[model samples]
Target: MATWAIGDIQGCFDEFTALLRAIDFRPDRDRLWLVGDLVNRGPKSLETLRFVHSLGDGAITLLGNHDLHLLAVAAGHGRLRRGDTLDEVLGAPDREPLLDWLRGRPLFHYDPALDMAMVHAALAPGWDLATAKTRAAEVQTALTSDADGYFAHMYGDTPHRWDNALRGWRRLRVITDYLTRVRFCRPDGTYDMRAKGPPGTQPEGYLPWFALPDRASAGTPIVFGHWSSIGLVDGHDVYALDTGCVWGRQLSALCLEEGRWVSVDCSARGSGAGD
Candidate 1:
């Protein structure tokens, strides 16, 4: 069975399905690794969530920032942003189950045999695979056990760097950020949360998280999304597949075993970018 890794769908169900078709995805025989942002910003959030939920074991989906925001809003911890299209999901009959499944999803996934790891965004420069897994479990535990408290303190850009001594909400928030919202960061691993543009446009002292010198997770290949502006990156043992389908670009997928890409145009379904 082939394993295919796909970029953020962001509720663009038509483009998602089209890309699936383009890849000749066979749910019965193939497994899918989705880089999250499964819902929000497009026209059919409910449909997109339902379809992915229906896939069950056929797919492994990480929780993106949008996915967490949906849960936070549903739990009354977050306010809806101007471009959010998550109302349908919030109002759906199956919203509870859908959100529950999403909350339980891990922030990181690893395949020891392939030595490949996946996260919605980037790993902290200091975190090797072992540290990533442990830290991810910490947040997962908090999310599952005290979602109210977890979402309550989830928003922020402080503690811009990871510290082994961090604890409580501070620790959880930093881990969540690294696994979900990270982009440009300093060589010392301090995140430049404000820099969202492409690589060359990063702030003076920052570089893409993956480009950080001597990153502990450097050797192992990482499949990630969340930086659509940079589009598809297929080298340096990093696979960035978020091709901005929601922004009138292509929805991309990479065959893990073969390292080949299959994409579908999404201009007709484009609805601009939304966080």
Candidate 2:
């Protein structure tokens, strides 16, 4: 069986399917590691969610910021913003089951045999694999057990650094940000939440999270998306698969075993700004 890691879908169902076809994906024999953003900002949020949900065990999807936003909005904690195309999903008959499945999805996934880890965004400089797993579980527990409470305090950019002493919703929010919203940060693990441009555009004193010196997770190969501006990076023992598909670029996929890429052009489908 083959394992393919795909970049963000972001509700671009047609492009997603096209990429799947280009990769010759067979649900019965291949597994998909989706780097989240499964819905939002594209033309078919509802269809995208339904299709991924139908994949069941054939796919392992992390929860991206968009997915979390969907959950938050569904739970009445977040409001739909301009350019959001999630109305169909919110109005769908299966919205509850879809949101439930999404909420239950983990923030991190690791495959020991492959010696690879996946997250929707970047890992904090301080978190090694074991620590990442533990921290992820903390948010997962809060999301499942106290979603109301978690979502209530989920949106923020404070506590810009990781602290072992952090407590309550602040702790959960930072953890979630590292896994889902981070891009640039300092070697000290302080996030520059405002820098969203490609490399060389980060604010002074900041480096891309993966480029931070002596990152604890540096030894293990990581697969991640969420930074579409710096598309398709294969170095630093990490694979960045977000090729800006939602922005009129290519939808990319990497074969885990072969380390080869298969992409589908998405110029026709791309629209809206990427987060």
Candidate 3:
């Protein structure tokens, strides 16, 4: 069996199909690991969601910020903003099954056999691999529960930092934001919602999550998207594959087994930087 971990799709279904064909993916024997943002911003939000849903057990997807936004909007915690392209998913006749399946999907995925973990965004600093796996599950449980009261508190900043003692909906919100929306965090682990660029441009007080001291997963290959500005930083066992395909640049795919990286030119990727 072969496993390939690809970067953020962001609704560029055509680019994704090209990548899969280029890799000659064998559905029966190959497993695909997607780093999330499977929908929104591109022209094929519905198609992207449906395609990944069709993959079923053959694919492993870690929830990205956009994915979480879709879930929150579905559950009534978030409101759609301009440029959001998830209307089809929210109104589909199969909405129930689709949202149910999506809400239950893992936010952070790790395969010990491959010595790799894939997340939509970077892991919080100070967390080892085990810490990430454990904490990720905690929020996943809350989000997947019928008592999704957690969604009500999903827009806050108090629980922005990890606290083992955090309980209930607030805890779930913090966990969700970190796992899904986090980019740069202050040295004390507080997230800087205002900063949204490469580590070099980040405010002086913040650091990239992976660059923090004592980062246990520094040796384990961690695949993530959400940072097209950082592009493809090949260091400390971390890879950033969101080359802003939805912004009309190029879509990227990093083949885990072959160590082969491919980028396909795109005309409709995300152009909203400093966004």
Candidate 4:
């Protein structure tokens, strides 16, 4: 039974299927792990969601920012923005089961047998393997519980240092941002929601989350998406799998068991089109 960790799908259903075919993925035998962003921005969000939901126990998915945005909009927390393309899902006939399955998903997932912890974004510095699992569980538990209030509060870009005393919706928002939208943080742990390009463009005193000192899950591989502009980066310990699927470049997948990368070119599509 092979286990493959695929990059952000972001609604690019065609590429997803092509990649699976290329890998000879058999749902009945092989397990598939996803870095998340299974829907949104691409042309076939509905198909993507359906395929993922059917994977059942053979699938491991860590939630991505777009995935949450879908839930938020479905729950009436956010409006559809320009360039958004998720209507097919929010208006689908089977939307209830899909959304429920998504809500039940977690922000972090690790199989100790695989020795890998998966997330949507980078882990904060100074957290060890245990801490990664613990903190991820903390936020995910809240999201899975009575989290309507949590969704209402999961916006903004302030109150940066992760203090345990952080209470109410504000705390939930911070944790959500960390697990979902973060790329870089200030030296003191302030999030940079504005920085979106590759590394090195951040202001002084701000550094990418992976660059922080004594990071959590130091040697354990963390498969993640959510930074297409960041592309595929190899930091020796983390896998940046958001290979600009929505940007007309390519969708990527890594065989974690062997640390192999396979990319399906989306350049055949329009220059600025992908998921």
For all candidates in order, the CA lDDT equals: 0.90, 0.92, 0.80, 0.80
Name model 1 segments beyond 4 Å from true.
Answer: 268-274
Q: What C-alpha root-mean-square deviation, in Å, does candidate 1 show against the real structure?
A: 1.2
Evaluation by TM-score, superior candidate among 2 and 4: 2
> What lDDT does candidate 1 reach at residue 149?
99
Judged by lDDT relative to the true structure, which candidate is superior, 1 or 4?
1
| Residues 221-254, model 1: lDDT tens digits | 8999998888889877799989888888888999
Q: Best candidate, lDDT-wise?
A: 2
Error of 4 at 7 (Å): 1.0
**Model 4 error, position 271 (Å):** 6.6
Candidate 4 differs from the real structure by a C-alpha RMSD in angstroms, to one decimal, of: 2.0
Q: Candidate 3: worst 10 consecutive residues by lDDT?
A: 266-275
For 47-80, candidate 2 gives per-residue lDDT tens digits of 9999999999999999999999999999999999
What lDDT does model 3 reach? 0.80
The top-ranked prediction according to TM-score is 2
Cα error, residue 192 of model 3, in Å, equals 0.6
lDDT of 4 by residue, 110-163 (tens): 888998878888666655667667777776787778667667777667776676
TM-score for each model:
0.97, 0.98, 0.94, 0.93
Better of 1 and 3 by TM-score: 1
- Model 4 poorest ten-residue lDDT run: 266-275
